[model samples]
Target: MKNFLSALAVSAVLVSCSKKEATPVPEKADTAKIVDSINAARTKINDSIRSKNHFKDFSGPHTFTHNSIKNPGSVHFEKIKGEADHYNIKGDIKSGKSYVHIDGFMAVVSDKHMNFTGNISESVAGSENGKLYVRRGTKTFMSKDGGKTYRLQDMVNGSGFVEYIDIHF
Candidate 1:
């Protein structure tokens, strides 16, 4: 009887030790879904770049369409007499007692690509106090698909202000 009881106890311990819950296996990620999500994000960013904002917000890293930039302000461009692709460009932004002056030389590489060399200076004669701001740099703007969408190149440290502005000619 004693031996039988000892055998039964050992069997109970073995049964308890063998009973274990199985771990769940994780499902594999769907590659197609991930790709689609990434593509959607890219499309959203590209669309925003193609959109236009007010001239005061013309900060760089954005693309501008010819039609979108129309009549934004007093913008003018004159071709250099002897130069094939050289042009003198100027723009003015006025709001009540404040104004900004943008002057530059544009070198057009093609209908979709161009380079700008110039300065954007502004004088604000507001109620508080007057202030002056000036910056000079060269920036290249290009479009991958002809003239539909254009973007600026080398945006790192491109402007002394918040961002570099795009001037469409």
Candidate 2:
């Protein structure tokens, strides 16, 4: 009888384990909140007015890659010494205003990769010295190496135009 009881208990356990969980179905009306949430989401970053302070100011060297466009490239900018407090990211818009922070449903559709150069100097890692760009708003990008000493825009080439480092095949 004990053996039979143990087998029954094992069978019950297996049966219970085989049961599947139901996925919760959200109410249809709840999805209506999408439009309302979008309207209310206009508080900061993507929705706010852009300025020089919208993006980050750095005190070291860093690598930034622009991977959102059909084609992509990179930039290596080094932070000038004694220029942190006065640091500014200078930028202008091509179609609309720029952002200083991350915001909204704005998919930063472009992929980006950055490596911060912690307290880097001209002595080592040899930085590119005078490259500048505008991301959005008034925030501008700056580099110090003919825009090539550090950042590798191999996919594109620099131009007199400030935005969109034009790359031609």
Candidate 3:
């Protein structure tokens, strides 16, 4: 009888030891689904705007003339040190003695729109540093020696223009 009891105890211990433990499964996050939903909503808004032809009035054909600043060798805007909204615009005109260097601030109108407006804070041409306004998708104008002089670098065929920059934010 004692032997029978000891055998039963050993069998119970072995069975308990041989059993496998179950591991818990982790749940997946829904971040990807949320991002996809936001992207779909933005696309729907853009499609609605396009269907209404909201941007049709701002479209025009570009004509390059001799007066235009032709063939800019290289143009680049670098952020100014210690200034978040300020930038240094530097560029060279091909085959021309003129050089352009200006300080400006870029303002974003929307997630897809932006513009630059500032003074020709400095220039090599002369003391003609004046207000420089470059409206994206519209026109670019520079005033030299203050507002006393104005030069149209680029413009559409209309008197008034709406400017916007194409960008995805």
Candidate 4:
């Protein structure tokens, strides 16, 4: 009986020793999913910031109305160092297969007024097809409704015509 009990104990020990615990397998990283989540988070943060500071963040796409014709355009506004409510502006407008580019500075004089001084560069259709004429001039714009709308008193290439180019924000 003692021999039988000792053999049984030995068999139990051997079986226990042969059994192994399974190790967990690591998962492969999904790089595309990670990147998409990161981009979504960044966009959310940017939208929050834009909502809080819409006036300062008006540096994106805008309507560039010139000669009663509205054009699609984009503007970049950078805050000037050491200046209050001043910005350096640069933008381009797509006008009927031609592009009009402007580089300028803007000053927020008051809550209801703003001023802009810039140089305009535009390509005009010449007398013949495929011929382009470049027009360069200075422009001064004023906004009385807190940048909601701007009136261009000075135009590109000429003045006595009193051309009004509205820049709608």
Candidate 5:
């Protein structure tokens, strides 16, 4: 009887020991990169105001119809550009704000109007994928579905800064 009790206690202890520890979820790795991209796109768009010929945003017709351009033919996916209509708290109106940019491409999330607060994380199909931008040249751009995913021939042109304002895209 004593041996049986000892065996039961030992089995109980072993069973409890076998229980696994909860694995910690690692944090997203590319946060800073995304922020940088969004900032760069914003800067490029801002620059466009003074020069209409500034870095342009290309889409369906712009990508395919133009014989001067070449690509995989059609956007990897399609990102719709959303308008940025918000302004500073100090009563300063943002003429047009487009904080994000894609190379010759761009997209605006249109589910609802978004307000950027200097800090932004990429959102797509409703998921917070990655940081918005990284350095291509002197400007930044945005990525929606992590770096791996993309929107086909989409762009938000006109104002560099993003606001609720609409664009050609």
Candidate 6:
């Protein structure tokens, strides 16, 4: 009987030791979803560039003001004809010192729109091989590659918004 009890205790220990908690298997990432997201970002960047190009033939003086709740001040552009035609841009932001007297090539200007292409001369943001677009009383867009890519500079409550006030040519 004593031997049998000892055997039973050993069997119980073995049974308990054999039971194990299952480990969870790792799930694979969805490659198709990742690819789709990347494609969407590329499409957005391309679209922005194309939109900036739409105003490539515009010139003359212009002003852009934020229409949103956020007050980023304003931007002003004046085309000057000289040895090389260029535009002087002044951006007055409420937060810091204004970007004053920046120069870029005035590529084109129409009755209601204007475009400026930047080079190494301009010290403003997006002034390196960039382009600025302004449509009268509508919107403003800036690019870093002569309209090959663009971004709306106006912000609404600190978030990016396309709307601008009196973006006149």
Candidates' lDDT values, in order?
0.58, 0.31, 0.39, 0.62, 0.33, 0.43
Q: What lDDT score goes with residue 130 in model 5?
A: 21
In terms of TM-score, how similar is model 6 to the real structure?
Answer: 0.27
Off by over 4 Å in 5: 1-9, 19-28, 50-169
Model 6 agreement with the true structure over 43-141: per-residue lDDT tens digits: 988766644533343344444443332333445555443312235655443322222232344433332333444421111232222233332222334
lDDT of prediction 3: 0.39
TM-score of each candidate? Answer: 0.41, 0.17, 0.25, 0.48, 0.21, 0.27
Clashing residue pairs in candidate 1 (N, C-alpha, C atoms within 3 angstroms)? 60-164
Model 1 Cα displacement at 165 (Å)?
2.7
**What is the TM-score (0 to 1) of candidate 5?**
0.21
RMSD, each candidate, Å? 16.5, 20.3, 14.8, 13.5, 23.1, 18.0
Task: Name the top TM-score candidate.
Answer: 4
Candidate 1 lDDT tens digits, 9-50: 999999988968988999989999999999999987876654
Which of 4 and 5 is ahead in TM-score? 4
Location of the lowest summed lDDT over 10 successive residues in candidate 6: 120-129
Clashing pairs in 4: none
lDDT for residue 11 in candidate 1, whole number 0-100 = 97
Q: Which prediction has more favorable lDDT, 1 or 5?
A: 1
Indicate the TM-score of model 2: 0.17
Model 3 C-alpha lDDT per residue in residues 1-169, reported as the tens digit of each score: 9999999999999998996888888887899999999999999887665444221122222221112333333334555443333334433332343333333454323223334565331122221332233223332444334332223344321224322111111
Error of 3 at 139 (Å): 7.8
